[model samples]
Target: MPSRWIATFDEPALVAQALTALADLGVPGTRLVSPAPYRAVHLTGQPGPWRAMGWLVLGGGLCGLATAIALEVGTSLAHPMHVGGQPVIAWVQFGVIMFEMTMLGAGLTNFLAMIVLGAWSRRQVAKAARDGLRSDRLTLAIPTSGRSPEQLQAIRAALVGATGIEEAP
Candidate 1:
Protein backbone atom coordinates (compact mmCIF):
# COMPACT_ATOMS: atom_id res chain seq x y z
CA MET A 1 0.00 0.00 0.00
CA PRO A 2 1.19 3.46 -0.89
CA SER A 3 0.46 5.89 1.94
CA ARG A 4 -0.29 9.49 1.02
CA TRP A 5 -1.08 12.68 2.90
CA ILE A 6 -2.44 16.15 2.27
CA ALA A 7 -2.61 19.44 4.14
CA THR A 8 -5.67 21.59 3.79
CA PHE A 9 -7.23 24.67 5.29
CA ASP A 10 -8.60 24.46 8.82
CA GLU A 11 -12.09 25.30 7.61
CA PRO A 12 -14.84 22.75 7.05
CA ALA A 13 -15.16 23.39 3.34
CA LEU A 14 -11.53 22.64 2.68
CA VAL A 15 -11.62 19.58 4.88
CA ALA A 16 -14.68 18.33 3.04
CA GLN A 17 -13.04 19.16 -0.27
CA ALA A 18 -9.93 17.21 0.65
CA LEU A 19 -11.97 14.22 1.68
CA THR A 20 -14.01 14.45 -1.47
CA ALA A 21 -10.87 14.64 -3.52
CA LEU A 22 -9.51 11.50 -1.93
CA ALA A 23 -12.77 9.67 -2.50
CA ASP A 24 -12.97 10.92 -6.05
CA LEU A 25 -9.40 9.77 -6.61
CA GLY A 26 -10.53 6.24 -5.82
CA VAL A 27 -8.14 5.71 -2.94
CA PRO A 28 -8.39 2.30 -1.27
CA GLY A 29 -8.17 3.39 2.37
CA THR A 30 -8.21 6.90 3.74
CA ARG A 31 -7.97 8.67 7.10
CA LEU A 32 -7.82 12.19 8.43
CA VAL A 33 -5.45 13.22 11.23
CA SER A 34 -5.87 16.62 12.77
CA PRO A 35 -4.56 18.74 15.59
CA ALA A 36 -8.17 19.05 16.75
CA PRO A 37 -11.24 17.08 15.82
CA TYR A 38 -13.29 17.67 12.67
CA ARG A 39 -16.95 17.13 13.46
CA ALA A 40 -17.90 15.59 10.13
CA VAL A 41 -14.83 13.37 9.95
CA HIS A 42 -15.78 10.97 12.73
CA LEU A 43 -19.56 10.86 12.26
CA THR A 44 -19.35 7.33 10.85
CA GLY A 45 -17.36 5.57 13.59
CA GLN A 46 -16.03 5.46 17.14
CA PRO A 47 -13.84 8.06 19.01
CA GLY A 48 -16.36 10.86 18.62
CA PRO A 49 -17.82 12.90 21.45
CA TRP A 50 -21.35 11.48 21.31
CA ARG A 51 -20.19 7.87 21.07
CA ALA A 52 -17.73 8.28 23.93
CA MET A 53 -20.26 9.99 26.16
CA GLY A 54 -23.00 7.56 25.25
CA TRP A 55 -20.90 4.57 26.22
CA LEU A 56 -19.75 6.31 29.38
CA VAL A 57 -23.30 7.09 30.44
CA LEU A 58 -24.55 3.62 29.63
CA GLY A 59 -21.68 1.83 31.36
CA GLY A 60 -21.72 4.17 34.32
CA GLY A 61 -25.47 3.83 34.74
CA LEU A 62 -25.16 0.05 34.72
CA CYS A 63 -22.28 0.17 37.16
CA GLY A 64 -24.23 2.47 39.43
CA LEU A 65 -27.22 0.15 39.41
CA ALA A 66 -24.99 -2.80 40.13
CA THR A 67 -23.28 -0.92 42.92
CA ALA A 68 -26.63 -0.13 44.51
CA ILE A 69 -27.66 -3.77 44.32
CA ALA A 70 -24.31 -4.98 45.64
CA LEU A 71 -24.37 -2.56 48.54
CA GLU A 72 -27.89 -3.59 49.46
CA VAL A 73 -27.05 -7.26 49.09
CA GLY A 74 -23.81 -7.18 51.08
CA THR A 75 -25.44 -5.17 53.84
CA SER A 76 -28.34 -7.54 53.97
CA LEU A 77 -25.99 -10.51 54.16
CA ALA A 78 -23.42 -9.13 56.60
CA HIS A 79 -25.53 -7.15 59.08
CA PRO A 80 -29.31 -7.54 58.90
CA MET A 81 -29.96 -4.74 61.36
CA HIS A 82 -33.52 -3.45 61.09
CA VAL A 83 -34.14 0.27 61.52
CA GLY A 84 -37.65 1.53 62.32
CA GLY A 85 -38.71 -2.04 61.59
CA GLN A 86 -38.01 -1.41 57.95
CA PRO A 87 -37.70 -4.11 55.28
CA VAL A 88 -34.40 -5.28 53.89
CA ILE A 89 -34.66 -2.92 50.91
CA ALA A 90 -34.81 0.35 52.74
CA TRP A 91 -35.88 2.82 50.06
CA VAL A 92 -34.53 6.03 51.58
CA GLN A 93 -31.08 4.73 52.48
CA PHE A 94 -30.78 2.84 49.22
CA GLY A 95 -31.84 5.95 47.35
CA VAL A 96 -29.01 7.93 48.90
CA ILE A 97 -26.46 5.28 47.98
CA MET A 98 -27.82 5.06 44.44
CA PHE A 99 -27.59 8.82 43.91
CA GLU A 100 -24.03 8.97 45.19
CA MET A 101 -22.94 5.94 43.19
CA THR A 102 -24.52 7.21 39.96
CA MET A 103 -22.87 10.60 40.16
CA LEU A 104 -19.48 9.16 41.08
CA GLY A 105 -19.56 6.48 38.41
CA ALA A 106 -20.81 8.79 35.70
CA GLY A 107 -18.20 11.44 36.36
CA LEU A 108 -15.30 9.01 36.59
CA THR A 109 -16.46 7.09 33.56
CA ASN A 110 -16.63 10.24 31.46
CA PHE A 111 -13.20 11.33 32.63
CA LEU A 112 -11.64 7.99 31.74
CA ALA A 113 -13.54 7.82 28.47
CA MET A 114 -12.10 11.11 27.29
CA ILE A 115 -8.60 10.06 28.19
CA VAL A 116 -8.99 6.69 26.49
CA LEU A 117 -10.28 8.33 23.33
CA GLY A 118 -7.06 10.36 23.01
CA ALA A 119 -8.71 13.67 23.78
CA TRP A 120 -5.74 15.14 25.67
CA SER A 121 -3.07 12.56 24.84
CA ARG A 122 0.31 13.58 23.50
CA ARG A 123 0.94 13.46 19.77
CA GLN A 124 4.06 14.36 17.82
CA VAL A 125 3.64 18.13 18.04
CA ALA A 126 6.16 18.85 15.27
CA LYS A 127 3.93 17.06 12.76
CA ALA A 128 1.45 19.94 12.50
CA ALA A 129 3.74 22.47 10.85
CA ARG A 130 2.09 24.94 8.53
CA ASP A 131 1.34 28.63 8.20
CA GLY A 132 -1.97 30.42 8.79
CA LEU A 133 -3.54 27.54 10.69
CA ARG A 134 -6.67 28.37 12.62
CA SER A 135 -7.59 27.41 16.16
CA ASP A 136 -8.00 23.80 15.00
CA ARG A 137 -6.09 22.27 12.10
CA LEU A 138 -7.37 19.19 10.27
CA THR A 139 -5.11 17.08 8.05
CA LEU A 140 -6.37 14.25 5.86
CA ALA A 141 -4.18 11.25 5.04
CA ILE A 142 -5.12 8.32 2.79
CA PRO A 143 -3.46 4.95 2.27
CA THR A 144 -3.68 3.08 -1.00
CA SER A 145 -3.05 -0.62 -1.42
CA GLY A 146 -2.10 -2.53 -4.63
CA ARG A 147 -2.66 0.44 -6.90
CA SER A 148 -1.83 0.63 -10.59
CA PRO A 149 0.91 2.98 -11.70
CA GLU A 150 -1.65 5.28 -13.27
CA GLN A 151 -3.54 5.52 -10.00
CA LEU A 152 -0.35 6.24 -8.06
CA GLN A 153 0.55 8.90 -10.60
CA ALA A 154 -2.83 10.51 -10.23
CA ILE A 155 -2.51 10.58 -6.43
CA ARG A 156 1.01 11.93 -6.59
CA ALA A 157 -0.16 14.70 -8.86
CA ALA A 158 -2.99 15.54 -6.49
CA LEU A 159 -0.64 15.94 -3.53
CA VAL A 160 1.61 18.64 -4.96
CA GLY A 161 3.03 20.22 -1.79
CA ALA A 162 1.37 18.07 0.86
CA THR A 163 3.59 16.37 3.46
CA GLY A 164 3.37 13.71 6.20
CA ILE A 165 3.09 10.45 4.29
CA GLU A 166 3.74 7.88 7.01
CA GLU A 167 2.09 4.48 7.12
CA ALA A 168 0.24 3.21 10.16
CA PRO A 169 0.37 -0.38 11.37
Candidate 2:
Protein backbone atom coordinates (compact mmCIF):
# COMPACT_ATOMS: atom_id res chain seq x y z
CA MET A 1 0.00 0.00 0.00
CA PRO A 2 1.13 3.54 -0.66
CA SER A 3 1.67 5.80 2.34
CA ARG A 4 1.03 9.56 2.19
CA TRP A 5 3.09 12.24 3.87
CA ILE A 6 1.69 15.68 4.54
CA ALA A 7 4.00 18.65 4.73
CA THR A 8 2.82 22.05 5.82
CA PHE A 9 4.63 25.19 4.66
CA ASP A 10 4.22 28.65 6.07
CA GLU A 11 5.46 30.36 2.93
CA PRO A 12 4.48 29.82 -0.68
CA ALA A 13 8.13 29.94 -1.70
CA LEU A 14 8.89 26.93 0.47
CA VAL A 15 5.99 25.03 -1.03
CA ALA A 16 7.23 25.94 -4.51
CA GLN A 17 10.72 24.73 -3.69
CA ALA A 18 9.40 21.48 -2.31
CA LEU A 19 7.33 20.96 -5.42
CA THR A 20 10.33 21.50 -7.66
CA ALA A 21 12.43 19.12 -5.58
CA LEU A 22 9.71 16.48 -5.70
CA ALA A 23 9.45 16.89 -9.45
CA ASP A 24 13.22 16.45 -9.73
CA LEU A 25 12.88 13.22 -7.76
CA GLY A 26 10.34 12.01 -10.36
CA VAL A 27 7.48 11.87 -7.88
CA PRO A 28 4.08 11.66 -9.51
CA GLY A 29 0.65 12.58 -8.20
CA THR A 30 1.85 15.11 -5.63
CA ARG A 31 -1.01 17.41 -4.62
CA LEU A 32 -0.73 20.89 -3.17
CA VAL A 33 -3.45 22.09 -0.81
CA SER A 34 -3.79 25.80 -0.25
CA PRO A 35 -6.56 28.05 0.97
CA ALA A 36 -5.82 30.63 -1.71
CA PRO A 37 -4.25 30.43 -5.14
CA TYR A 38 -0.47 30.71 -5.32
CA ARG A 39 1.23 31.57 -8.58
CA ALA A 40 4.56 30.21 -7.39
CA VAL A 41 3.22 26.66 -7.05
CA HIS A 42 0.96 26.61 -10.05
CA LEU A 43 1.45 23.49 -12.17
CA THR A 44 1.63 23.86 -15.92
CA GLY A 45 0.87 21.61 -18.92
CA GLN A 46 -2.52 20.56 -17.62
CA PRO A 47 -5.48 20.76 -19.95
CA GLY A 48 -8.36 22.83 -18.57
CA PRO A 49 -12.11 22.33 -18.96
CA TRP A 50 -12.60 25.29 -21.29
CA ARG A 51 -11.18 23.48 -24.30
CA ALA A 52 -13.50 20.52 -23.85
CA MET A 53 -16.45 22.79 -23.18
CA GLY A 54 -15.80 24.74 -26.36
CA TRP A 55 -15.75 21.55 -28.39
CA LEU A 56 -18.96 20.37 -26.77
CA VAL A 57 -20.66 23.68 -27.49
CA LEU A 58 -19.57 23.52 -31.11
CA GLY A 59 -20.94 20.01 -31.45
CA GLY A 60 -24.24 21.06 -29.92
CA GLY A 61 -24.55 23.94 -32.33
CA LEU A 62 -23.85 21.68 -35.29
CA CYS A 63 -26.48 19.22 -34.12
CA GLY A 64 -28.96 22.05 -33.73
CA LEU A 65 -28.21 23.25 -37.26
CA ALA A 66 -28.76 19.76 -38.61
CA THR A 67 -32.03 19.48 -36.76
CA ALA A 68 -33.24 22.81 -38.08
CA ILE A 69 -32.30 21.88 -41.62
CA ALA A 70 -34.13 18.55 -41.34
CA LEU A 71 -37.20 20.13 -39.84
CA GLU A 72 -37.48 22.85 -42.47
CA VAL A 73 -36.58 20.71 -45.51
CA GLY A 74 -38.51 17.69 -44.40
CA THR A 75 -41.62 19.67 -43.65
CA SER A 76 -41.42 21.61 -46.91
CA LEU A 77 -40.93 18.43 -48.91
CA ALA A 78 -43.76 16.64 -47.16
CA HIS A 79 -46.23 19.44 -47.93
CA PRO A 80 -44.89 21.36 -50.90
CA MET A 81 -45.77 24.99 -50.28
CA HIS A 82 -44.95 27.23 -53.27
CA VAL A 83 -45.87 30.81 -52.40
CA GLY A 84 -45.54 33.68 -54.92
CA GLY A 85 -43.44 31.46 -57.17
CA GLN A 86 -40.93 31.01 -54.38
CA PRO A 87 -39.04 27.75 -53.82
CA VAL A 88 -40.66 25.05 -51.68
CA ILE A 89 -37.70 25.00 -49.25
CA ALA A 90 -36.55 28.60 -48.89
CA TRP A 91 -33.14 29.01 -47.22
CA VAL A 92 -33.82 32.67 -46.34
CA GLN A 93 -36.96 31.85 -44.37
CA PHE A 94 -35.20 28.95 -42.57
CA GLY A 95 -32.32 31.21 -41.45
CA VAL A 96 -34.20 32.47 -38.40
CA ILE A 97 -35.03 28.98 -37.13
CA MET A 98 -31.52 27.71 -37.75
CA PHE A 99 -29.93 30.67 -35.97
CA GLU A 100 -32.28 30.46 -33.02
CA MET A 101 -31.80 26.71 -32.61
CA THR A 102 -28.04 26.94 -32.85
CA MET A 103 -27.87 29.71 -30.24
CA LEU A 104 -30.18 27.77 -27.94
CA GLY A 105 -28.11 24.60 -28.27
CA ALA A 106 -24.82 26.37 -27.61
CA GLY A 107 -26.20 28.27 -24.64
CA LEU A 108 -27.67 25.14 -23.06
CA THR A 109 -24.45 23.20 -23.57
CA ASN A 110 -22.37 25.96 -21.98
CA PHE A 111 -24.72 26.13 -19.00
CA LEU A 112 -24.58 22.38 -18.38
CA ALA A 113 -20.80 22.34 -18.69
CA MET A 114 -20.49 25.09 -16.09
CA ILE A 115 -22.66 23.12 -13.65
CA VAL A 116 -20.65 19.91 -14.08
CA LEU A 117 -17.31 21.65 -13.76
CA GLY A 118 -18.46 23.58 -10.69
CA ALA A 119 -19.61 20.39 -8.97
CA TRP A 120 -16.37 18.60 -9.79
CA SER A 121 -14.29 21.46 -8.36
CA ARG A 122 -16.45 21.54 -5.24
CA ARG A 123 -15.89 17.84 -4.67
CA GLN A 124 -12.15 18.30 -5.03
CA VAL A 125 -12.19 21.16 -2.52
CA ALA A 126 -14.12 19.03 -0.04
CA LYS A 127 -11.65 16.21 -0.42
CA ALA A 128 -8.74 18.58 0.12
CA ALA A 129 -10.41 19.88 3.28
CA ARG A 130 -10.58 16.31 4.55
CA ASP A 131 -6.87 15.90 3.85
CA GLY A 132 -5.62 18.40 6.43
CA LEU A 133 -6.07 21.49 4.31
CA ARG A 134 -5.94 24.68 6.36
CA SER A 135 -6.79 28.30 5.80
CA ASP A 136 -3.55 29.74 7.18
CA ARG A 137 -0.97 27.38 5.72
CA LEU A 138 -0.17 25.44 2.59
CA THR A 139 -0.07 21.64 2.56
CA LEU A 140 1.67 19.24 0.23
CA ALA A 141 0.58 15.61 0.12
CA ILE A 142 3.36 13.33 -1.06
CA PRO A 143 2.89 9.63 -1.62
CA THR A 144 5.80 7.70 -0.16
CA SER A 145 4.59 4.25 -0.96
CA GLY A 146 6.55 2.07 -3.42
CA ARG A 147 9.59 4.21 -2.76
CA SER A 148 12.97 2.98 -1.62
CA PRO A 149 14.38 4.03 1.73
CA GLU A 150 16.90 6.27 0.00
CA GLN A 151 14.17 7.98 -1.98
CA LEU A 152 12.07 8.45 1.16
CA GLN A 153 15.05 9.98 2.90
CA ALA A 154 15.62 12.27 -0.07
CA ILE A 155 12.00 13.41 0.08
CA ARG A 156 12.30 14.22 3.77
CA ALA A 157 15.56 16.04 3.19
CA ALA A 158 13.94 18.10 0.46
CA LEU A 159 11.17 19.17 2.81
CA VAL A 160 13.47 19.73 5.81
CA GLY A 161 12.62 23.41 6.31
CA ALA A 162 8.84 23.06 6.03
CA THR A 163 6.71 24.27 8.95
CA GLY A 164 5.65 20.74 9.83
CA ILE A 165 5.81 17.27 8.29
CA GLU A 166 3.95 14.12 9.24
CA GLU A 167 2.50 10.96 7.81
CA ALA A 168 -1.18 10.84 6.96
CA PRO A 169 -3.19 8.38 9.04
Candidate 3:
Protein backbone atom coordinates (compact mmCIF):
# COMPACT_ATOMS: atom_id res chain seq x y z
CA MET A 1 0.00 0.00 0.00
CA PRO A 2 1.10 3.55 -0.64
CA SER A 3 2.16 5.66 2.34
CA ARG A 4 1.00 9.18 3.26
CA TRP A 5 0.92 12.32 1.14
CA ILE A 6 1.87 15.57 2.87
CA ALA A 7 0.76 19.05 1.77
CA THR A 8 2.14 22.01 3.66
CA PHE A 9 0.19 25.24 4.08
CA ASP A 10 1.38 28.59 5.36
CA GLU A 11 -2.08 29.90 6.25
CA PRO A 12 -4.79 28.25 8.34
CA ALA A 13 -7.46 29.12 5.76
CA LEU A 14 -5.58 27.25 3.11
CA VAL A 15 -5.39 24.25 5.40
CA ALA A 16 -9.12 24.33 5.96
CA GLN A 17 -9.81 24.58 2.23
CA ALA A 18 -7.42 21.75 1.51
CA LEU A 19 -9.08 19.60 4.17
CA THR A 20 -12.51 20.25 2.72
CA ALA A 21 -11.28 19.55 -0.78
CA LEU A 22 -9.69 16.27 0.28
CA ALA A 23 -12.76 15.17 2.18
CA ASP A 24 -14.92 16.02 -0.83
CA LEU A 25 -12.59 13.89 -2.89
CA GLY A 26 -13.20 11.00 -0.49
CA VAL A 27 -9.64 10.92 0.77
CA PRO A 28 -9.04 8.63 3.72
CA GLY A 29 -6.80 9.28 6.73
CA THR A 30 -6.70 13.03 6.20
CA ARG A 31 -5.02 14.93 9.02
CA LEU A 32 -3.27 18.18 9.82
CA VAL A 33 0.04 18.99 11.52
CA SER A 34 0.64 22.42 12.97
CA PRO A 35 3.25 24.11 15.14
CA ALA A 36 0.66 25.04 17.78
CA PRO A 37 -3.06 24.74 18.40
CA TYR A 38 -5.20 26.73 15.97
CA ARG A 39 -8.98 26.75 15.56
CA ALA A 40 -9.26 27.85 11.95
CA VAL A 41 -9.02 24.47 10.30
CA HIS A 42 -12.13 22.40 11.01
CA LEU A 43 -11.56 18.75 10.23
CA THR A 44 -14.24 16.64 8.54
CA GLY A 45 -15.49 13.12 9.35
CA GLN A 46 -15.03 11.27 12.65
CA PRO A 47 -12.09 12.09 14.90
CA GLY A 48 -9.21 9.81 15.72
CA PRO A 49 -10.03 6.59 17.57
CA TRP A 50 -8.41 7.32 20.94
CA ARG A 51 -11.54 7.44 23.09
CA ALA A 52 -10.62 4.11 24.72
CA MET A 53 -8.09 5.88 26.93
CA GLY A 54 -10.84 7.33 29.12
CA TRP A 55 -12.40 3.92 29.68
CA LEU A 56 -8.99 2.39 30.34
CA VAL A 57 -8.20 4.98 32.99
CA LEU A 58 -11.58 4.53 34.64
CA GLY A 59 -11.07 0.76 34.77
CA GLY A 60 -7.61 1.22 36.25
CA GLY A 61 -8.88 3.58 38.93
CA LEU A 62 -11.72 1.24 39.89
CA CYS A 63 -9.32 -1.70 40.10
CA GLY A 64 -6.97 0.33 42.26
CA LEU A 65 -9.80 1.25 44.64
CA ALA A 66 -10.95 -2.35 44.84
CA THR A 67 -7.41 -3.55 45.50
CA ALA A 68 -6.91 -0.93 48.17
CA ILE A 69 -10.15 -1.91 49.97
CA ALA A 70 -9.27 -5.60 49.79
CA LEU A 71 -5.78 -5.08 51.17
CA GLU A 72 -6.80 -2.79 54.02
CA VAL A 73 -9.93 -4.65 55.09
CA GLY A 74 -8.72 -8.18 54.36
CA THR A 75 -5.44 -7.67 56.22
CA SER A 76 -7.20 -6.23 59.23
CA LEU A 77 -9.64 -9.12 59.31
CA ALA A 78 -6.96 -11.80 58.78
CA HIS A 79 -4.84 -10.62 61.71
CA PRO A 80 -6.91 -8.39 63.94
CA MET A 81 -4.85 -5.41 65.07
CA HIS A 82 -5.58 -2.45 67.32
CA VAL A 83 -3.86 0.90 67.12
CA GLY A 84 -4.90 3.90 69.18
CA GLY A 85 -8.02 1.86 70.06
CA GLN A 86 -9.43 2.62 66.63
CA PRO A 87 -11.48 0.17 64.54
CA VAL A 88 -9.45 -2.68 63.02
CA ILE A 89 -10.54 -1.79 59.44
CA ALA A 90 -9.70 1.89 59.80
CA TRP A 91 -11.63 3.48 56.92
CA VAL A 92 -10.34 6.98 57.66
CA GLN A 93 -6.73 5.88 57.72
CA PHE A 94 -7.11 3.98 54.46
CA GLY A 95 -8.47 6.98 52.54
CA VAL A 96 -5.06 8.41 51.78
CA ILE A 97 -3.72 5.10 50.50
CA MET A 98 -6.77 4.54 48.36
CA PHE A 99 -6.51 7.99 46.78
CA GLU A 100 -2.82 7.55 46.07
CA MET A 101 -3.34 4.12 44.54
CA THR A 102 -6.19 5.36 42.34
CA MET A 103 -4.08 8.20 41.01
CA LEU A 104 -1.13 5.87 40.49
CA GLY A 105 -3.30 3.47 38.52
CA ALA A 106 -4.69 6.20 36.24
CA GLY A 107 -1.28 7.80 35.71
CA LEU A 108 0.43 4.52 34.95
CA THR A 109 -2.30 3.50 32.53
CA ASN A 110 -2.01 6.82 30.68
CA PHE A 111 1.77 6.56 30.46
CA LEU A 112 1.64 2.99 29.16
CA ALA A 113 -1.07 3.85 26.65
CA MET A 114 0.98 6.67 25.20
CA ILE A 115 4.02 4.44 24.90
CA VAL A 116 1.96 1.77 23.15
CA LEU A 117 0.53 4.34 20.72
CA GLY A 118 4.01 5.60 19.72
CA ALA A 119 3.27 9.09 20.99
CA TRP A 120 6.93 9.41 22.03
CA SER A 121 8.41 7.77 18.96
CA ARG A 122 11.19 9.67 17.17
CA ARG A 123 10.27 8.23 13.75
CA GLN A 124 7.84 11.06 12.92
CA VAL A 125 10.75 13.49 12.79
CA ALA A 126 12.13 11.91 9.61
CA LYS A 127 8.90 12.30 7.65
CA ALA A 128 9.07 16.05 6.87
CA ALA A 129 11.64 18.75 6.23
CA ARG A 130 13.29 20.30 9.29
CA ASP A 131 10.92 22.82 10.95
CA GLY A 132 8.26 21.96 8.36
CA LEU A 133 5.58 21.85 11.01
CA ARG A 134 7.11 24.66 13.05
CA SER A 135 7.50 28.41 12.49
CA ASP A 136 4.06 29.12 10.98
CA ARG A 137 3.49 26.05 8.84
CA LEU A 138 0.49 23.70 8.76
CA THR A 139 0.59 20.35 6.99
CA LEU A 140 -2.33 18.32 5.67
CA ALA A 141 -1.50 14.65 5.21
CA ILE A 142 -3.52 11.99 3.40
CA PRO A 143 -2.63 8.38 2.88
CA THR A 144 -2.38 7.53 -0.84
CA SER A 145 -3.18 3.86 -0.59
CA GLY A 146 -5.80 2.64 -3.10
CA ARG A 147 -6.07 6.11 -4.63
CA SER A 148 -6.25 6.40 -8.39
CA PRO A 149 -3.71 8.43 -10.31
CA GLU A 150 -6.51 10.83 -11.24
CA GLN A 151 -7.32 11.29 -7.57
CA LEU A 152 -3.70 12.00 -6.74
CA GLN A 153 -3.61 14.55 -9.56
CA ALA A 154 -6.76 16.13 -8.20
CA ILE A 155 -5.21 16.41 -4.73
CA ARG A 156 -2.11 18.02 -6.19
CA ALA A 157 -4.25 20.45 -8.12
CA ALA A 158 -6.27 21.27 -5.02
CA LEU A 159 -3.26 22.17 -2.90
CA VAL A 160 -1.81 24.88 -5.05
CA GLY A 161 1.40 26.59 -3.80
CA ALA A 162 1.95 23.87 -1.20
CA THR A 163 5.37 24.16 0.42
CA GLY A 164 5.89 20.45 0.10
CA ILE A 165 3.91 17.63 -1.53
CA GLU A 166 5.63 14.34 -1.00
CA GLU A 167 4.95 10.69 -0.19
CA ALA A 168 5.27 10.46 3.60
CA PRO A 169 6.48 7.25 5.15
- Number of the top candidate by lDDT? 2
TM-score of 3: 0.72
Q: Which candidate has the highest TM-score of all?
A: 3
Identify the superior model by lDDT, candidate 1 or candidate 2.
2
TM agreement with the true structure for every prediction = 0.60, 0.61, 0.72
Put the candidates in TM-score order, highest first. Answer: 3, 2, 1
Judged by whole-model lDDT over C-alpha atoms, candidate 2 comes out at: 0.77
Local distance difference test, candidate 3: 0.73
**What residue pairs are clashing in model 1?**
none
lDDT of 2 at 49: 63
Write one digit per residue (lDDT tens) for candidate 1, span 1-169: 5334445444655666555665677664455555565664652122435555877777987798789879887878688887788877677778877888887888888778878755443232223322224465555545556677798678656544353343432
What are the per-residue Cα lDDT tens digits for candidate 2 across 1-169? 4477878888887888888888888887677777787964475223446568888899888888888999999999999988999899899989999999998888888889888975775453325324676787888778788889899999998885688877763
